[model samples]
Target chain A: MDHPITVDSDACTRCGICIEICPMGIIAQDGPDDLPGLVPGGAAVCSRCGHCEAVCPAGAVSARYPACGPQHLPGGSAAIAPADLAAYLRARRTVRRYREECVDRETVEALLDVVRFAPSGMNGQPVHWLVVHDPAEVRRLAGLAIAWMREASRAGHPMADLFGVLVRTWDAGVDQICRGAPHLVIAHADAKNPMAYTDSIIALTWLEVAAPSFGLGTCWAGFFQMAASASPALAEALGLPEGHAPQYAMALGYPAYRFPRVPGREPVRVTWR
Target chain B: MDHPITVDSDACTRCGICIEICPMGIIAQDGPDDLPGLVPGGAAVCSRCGHCEAVCPAGAVSARYPACGPQHLPGGSAAIAPADLAAYLRARRTVRRYREECVDRETVEALLDVVRFAPSGMNGQPVHWLVVHDPAEVRRLAGLAIAWMREASRAGHPMADLFGVLVRTWDAGVDQICRGAPHLVIAHADAKNPMAYTDSIIALTWLEVAAPSFGLGTCWAGFFQMAASASPALAEALGLPEGHAPQYAMALGYPAYRFPRVPGREPVRVTWR
Candidate 1:
């Protein structure tokens, strides 16, 4: 069924571009008596290529792709390719333990190559990344983060439940959740710029998505990021610029465990209006 | 080619979770001398379901699906499938003009629904939204933005070239880009919160990815967002809370122009450690 590109008649300036650009010759003038409308009745068979979508200058048209969901990407491989998207999101777990092997610099670089393209607000492009490969340095940073979490937990902060789990794991002599992944990639951005964190996280998410493809595990290390903000010594050691602040950190490594089934979780709350 | 869940031996602490959870009988202790290595010649194929990822309390394991990129649940459809991660990244573009139709409330809600789940620093969840629906109000706000841009342009701001083009377009009887959209969604967070902008932006990116699938066009209206920040009257009208600051605004509608090819850009710089 073809749905005519719906436009607010009052808002339409008769740009006519929509009619000219429709790949399917379905859009046309409604004649002098009729307002501009689509031909072949109300339903227009749309290829869903989004050519009309990319061309409508008035920002008026809305196409409904019944099969498309909120996560669809226009012009990408699939707006919602089932295998890749599901596996990408489900595959990322907050990995904390690791084997002792070192991750080569080449692999880390390859991951960054993909992440470097993350969109920035106004293309401000304020985000920067720091890769820490020294094992000792990683441990030192992890120790500082653990110390912060321990103090917060002891002080009974509202997030103590999460921090408490971490402290207990640390006390149990389990490897640090960061698992001492030989490298720590820290994303930083201009603290004064409002969009820094968004840029950093987008890049980080890209890295997360790309990590599993490379057989590397990643755990978001918020504590380390916060530590960079809260402690000058940590920030200095990370070589952060004067106005730069760390937004997120990922501890990357290979997993030491495997489970057969997808883990259960509280269903995410999503309301369609 | 079954790899034994290669672990960074220096990074691992001999945690027994791998042995405890290996569904396949591939994992075993390599004698007391060889710190818990997986069998050298095992043919175990990782299901890559991320069960170990979820259960890895230490946050050490990372699994990458080579073909998939980041996965997200869009508007709560069954898990969105993944596509070629590289292809998806390559295909993303910055859309500007839009059509003349109004975006449905359901579409906006769906986008918000998906983006609302963006992780906040410490789960603060402090971000707020102001969805502008009134066409008249949208025009009024856009006029103010145009006024601001004109002033800045005359003052020879570095963006004068861009503003000149926008002004020229408006003078040529085309609707201002900011006013061209049927909906304006503004993201705000507490001004005092250093991470507010970052939080807002991550949420915005979520919306951006999810919008096109529903046949909606989105443009980053950073200048308008900035104008709102500068104009207290406008901010108050938008119902920004006393302490909250508007960080981003997006123009959403149908697209105005179509390009036959994805735009190419210079490669971004990325270095491996």
Candidate 2:
């Protein structure tokens, strides 16, 4: 990983913008007019946040580690207006009931493509996704979650009462664990990676937030995540990548209903310093 | 707490949709055909997730807990298209250098308004905010973070080398901690609330993702967060609620430069089961 960054000297203006923009303070210039490069031993401590590449005014800097790709955006500061973006964010809802029709791979892949850009600590980008593409497999996972809850209820755990209710609800065939959604998307990472949990949740949040614009809906699968954390049976069934655990799970599908109105939330509390 | 949900009888069709839609399964109907209402002790168990309210075909069911508000989406599912939303999200770039202009109270409040709808654990919605509004105060906080880093560097901390570099960078007059942004937004919550950390980060992420639309920019103040977590000097200066701790912080201000293209991220890795 020597010199994880490269400079297109053909386009370089020796402006030192990349050197100044490096979050790791790893890039350096030999003189005021010299082309910038990583200081000695820079790659070892580089956070891979890609600030150097993105901040290059001439597009002369490129970070090599993640494999950079070109992306075109609606130019200037007007991609979408403030009002429109606010409206879209406010309209997002935690979908409970999903249509039985299966979601296509291309649509789901598009979602992952958008989500891959979601931020991570030091740009570790450790999260990998597990999509339970088969609705039947999702159902099996939900059933295993219910099984864990029943055991917890029998053992009188701290949340035993709630578990009892969930178990009874499952018995009544409500499929509340996964909300009977046609698919489940789980973000997994090595348990050893300190950033894995927060990073995965952020990516999932981005996925859930962006899904609606894709003509899809998502719900945080809290029940399944709870069971997965402690239930070996459920974990074994999930068969996540070796050395990895599911950080969070999201119920993904086309929603069965449309929500035209955005519901209120608790009044925001703030302290101005 | 009784009857947290209300129904408009005129608008109600007795269609059994609300009864089936209640996530708590607390709504019930009587006889061959009956209007749905909360069963005995319904409100206590209600997750307040607003499924019944959002799922109603006639908009007859309203959850009193959240004080439901009328929100007009672009109408139908035609808000922003998938590709456009992805483009906008991808275009988001964290600001390291920002214009000196101060952010207005109205604009900050607007951002908070949109963020209030961000989902939380079981609708717990525990997060509150702290705005270090003055640029001078933001600088003070950044200096405090540097002070902490200096102390960490003095000791043989595992991250001592990185801290030493940051401390030297600070001594050389680069405000890397908060990036000299005009304002800092810190999400905080009661230490007892388990959902606080994740909820706060999600809300902050939403704020980061949507800032570009508002002609503003943000960077996760990871350095400030590091100091806030373990530095008594920083914590006392933050002056959060008595029972609360700062979950995460973001540096916010107008950008010094525009990012014309979306930078690439790591490849999307997925397992389909």
Candidate 3:
């Protein structure tokens, strides 16, 4: 296969940074001023991580695999200090109670735009997003999940006890399903990709970590995901792409309360090797 | 069952924030002077998120679940803006080439200290860390992984072809297994925990994202992990606690070079419901 890379001869200063930075050591040049090219069989083995395109000083190299090429990263005083970021991450609360306000479209777009940077296996980036924006629609889909749990409980599923509790809680007019949040975000991917599960979860974690900075909160929508996987009707309601399966979901909204301090955790269990 | 929470009445201001914020709606007060208490059967359904203890005004509420208590978060001018953080996350590189220097114990401890805050299912927080501090030890482990691949290739294992490439790469003086990284950070958890895999990956992603801030770099140790799971000797060498299995590993070290820009990715794919 031909190398999925292009070098702009006019713009190229031939710095050879791309040759040095490629993780697979695929790119090579015969001399300092020579234009770098992929070594024999390098195209087939390339992980498509784009380090070459990213490190190029003269905007000379481009990886065709990513399709989007390199991005213009915003920098300067806006950079976060390690201590401050640690504090921010620690102070994050799993918001279940939400104000009766909708997160605007632009803000959600911005959040996804940032989350697109989350890493993937060989940079395959197989994950996709399904956003349920309307709170009422979120509730409607959640009600379908409750119906699934009701059936599963009656059918003596192994998790019937848990399902029964969820069904009973729903009957009590309490939303134990989607947590009454204004929005629901689902990560989905092709069922066949081995890395799909890991990559999607990583991307969602990035989303969860970054949301608080935008004055938002998230709760893992475990019930919804389990139901979406088991119930055809719920999956139909999600309207995900043809081949994608729902991996997980998160409830999102403006938090009803602000957490003042970071709660503690179990003493970290570690064994240094 | 008695509630697992303890409240100090003398310190309690009766502000009722805990009652308002408990995700399970378990905490309650009967009167203006009454201290908050958990409703009957609340302990079983608490979810152990600790919002009550974290939100308390006078530090009066304490959850019995978390071994550690509330932490004083460093706030104010240190907090990062959304744009800056986006820049930081996007600009991160998976470092393969590393400077041959050991990261001091204090810095590694500080990084783990911050990483402990990564969220988990129902706040179970089951993930554990195994840090391989010595470079020679890391090389030894990598050699074991290569040995596993070499044997697998000879034995005609299903993944033998892939292992053949890795073994050949190692023989060619390219340390493809561990990439010559000085430290190997492994996240492990009880093999029985259903959420262990997801939670550990989330926590390690947090480590990878947070590392760049400390002038460190990380590359996912996929080859090493594949071998560790298949090679009992490598797993024994890790010396993880009983009942725990390695979920994932990452190679960590000071980067040999810095990339100037963020590589691009596929356009974000989404479906709005």
Evaluate model 3: give its TM-score.
0.94
Model 2 global lDDT (CA atoms, 0 to 1): 0.85
Residue A48 displacement in candidate 3 (angstroms): 3.3
List model 2 lDDT by residue over A1-273, tens digit each: 467889988899998877766777789988877778988899999887777777677888887875665554556533778888888888888888889999999899999999998988887889999999999999999999999999988998899998888888789888888999999999999999988998998899899878989889998998899999999999999888789988999999998877766767777778887
Clashes of each: 59, 0, 0
RMSD of each: 14.2, 2.1, 2.3
lDDT against the true structure, per candidate, is 0.60, 0.85, 0.85
Clashes of 2: 0
Docking class of 2: medium
DockQ of each: 0.09, 0.61, 0.65
What is the TM-score of candidate 1? Answer: 0.58
Q: Is candidate 1 or candidate 3 better by lDDT?
A: 3
B22 in model 3: Cα distance from truth in Å?
A: 2.2
Write the number of the candidate with greater DockQ, choosing between 2 and 3.
3
Looking at model 2 chain B, which ten-residue stretch has the lowest summed lDDT? B69-78
lDDT of 3 by residue, A1-273 (tens): 566788888888887778767877888888887878888898898887888888787878877874555775554532567787778777877887888899998899889988988988877889899899989999999999999999988998999998998888888988878888999999999989989999988999899888987888999888888899999999888888888899899999998887767777766666666
lDDT of 2 by residue, B28-67 (tens): 8885366788998888988877767766778888888755
Ranking by DockQ: 3, 2, 1
